[model samples]
Target: MDFEELYQDIVLDHSRRPRNFGELAEAQFHAHGDNPNCGDEVTVHLKLGANDAIDALTFTGNGCSICMASASLMTLKMKHKSRAESGELIHAFHDMLTAEQESEPDKRLGDLRVFQSVRRFPQRVKCATLPWHALEEALGKPAGGEVSFSEDTAG
Candidate 1:
């Protein structure tokens, strides 16, 4: 199959049967993010291991295919990553989606690169990024986790 077909299949598969789609009872960090424009909502749960490595992560939410797929792929990519590494990935992802000049997907993004095309659709960019913003919020603070994004605020 062609690359476009493969990418679509991967996205569809993840959206239909998202990985790590649940809650964590003993999570050290958790945060919720919502997009007011499209009504996408997601909560990210994270458990850190030795030296702030990501021990486990999951997400719970309802959104469009792009959002669900992104959450799924992000959970898979973040397994066992350090907090610093995850932060880098978050920045790379944001840059990939918002860059004024399109470029090849960053190698660091792994399977999450499937969403590269999302940048072309400005509206869908928010859908794909809602879960990521939630993840970022969970990592940014120690308590009282919540984040909200609108078309005006989200890049």
Candidate 2:
């Protein structure tokens, strides 16, 4: 199949039946993020393991296919990753989605790579990146135990 077909398949499959969807009963950290412009929102939950690895991760949300699918893919990609590693991957993902010129998404993203198309639609960038930012905020609020950020997409 071609790239469009592959992208569509992955996006549809993930959005329809996202992996790691719903909530984590033992989540050590949690955060809610929203994109008011498009009304996309997600709540991310995760558990930190012995060495700061994300032993469990999940999310609950209502968003566009891109947002929901990206969140689903993120849980799969982020599981077993150290906090620092997760941070790095988050940065890389945002970069990949927002890059100014067309280029291949990092192979490490696997199926998530199909999101490179998001670059062409700046508004959707917030939808795609919302979960990652929520994850970061969730992880960052170690003391608070929970965090939230409604993206100010207005420029």
Candidate 3:
């Protein structure tokens, strides 16, 4: 199959059977994000281990295929990564989708790069990113332990 087809299949697979698609009983951080325009909502749960590495990551929510697939891919990519590394990757992923010049996807993004085509659809962009925004919020408020992101106020 062609690369485009392969990418689509991968996304479909993840969306249909998302990995890490639940809550963490031992979560150290948690955050929720929603896109009011599309009604996509996601919550990220994190548990940090030694050296600030992600011991576990999971999510729970309902949204479009793009949103679900992105959340699944994000859990797989961020697992075992240090908080610092995950932070950089989060920025890189956002840049990949929002860059004005349509640049190459960062190698660090792994299969998460499959969503590059999402940039073409502005609305889909928010769908794919809602999970990441929640992850960012989770990572940022370590002390608070919980946070929320509403696209209405994100501007």
User: What lDDT does the true structure give each of the candidates?
Assistant: 0.83, 0.85, 0.88
Q: For model 3, where is the 10-residue window of minimal lDDT?
A: 1-10
RMSD of 3: 2.6
Model 3 over residues 1-155: C-alpha lDDT tens digits?
A: 34363359889999999999998999999999988887789999999897888999999999988999999999999999998899899999999999888998899998888888887676578888889999989988857488887886453
Best by lDDT: 3
lDDT of 2 by residue, 55-98 (tens): 99999989988899899999999999998888888878988977
**TM-score-best of 1 and 3:** 3
Note each model's CA RMSD in angstroms.
2.8, 2.3, 2.6
Ranking by TM-score: 3, 2, 1
What TM-score goes with each of the models?
Answer: 0.88, 0.91, 0.92
Where does candidate 1 stray beyond 4 Å? 1-7, 143-155
In candidate 1, how many clashes are counted?
0
Positional deviation of residue 112's Cα in model 2 after best superposition, in angstroms: 1.4
lDDT of 1 by residue, 39-94 (tens): 78898998888788899999998999889999999999999999889999998998
Residue-level error in angstroms, candidate 3, position 137: 0.4
Instruction: Show the lowest summed lDDT stretch of 10 residues, model 2.
Output: 1-10
Query: Which residue runs of candidate 2 sit more than 4 Å off their true CA positions?
Result: 1-7
Worst 10 residues of 1 by lDDT: 146-155
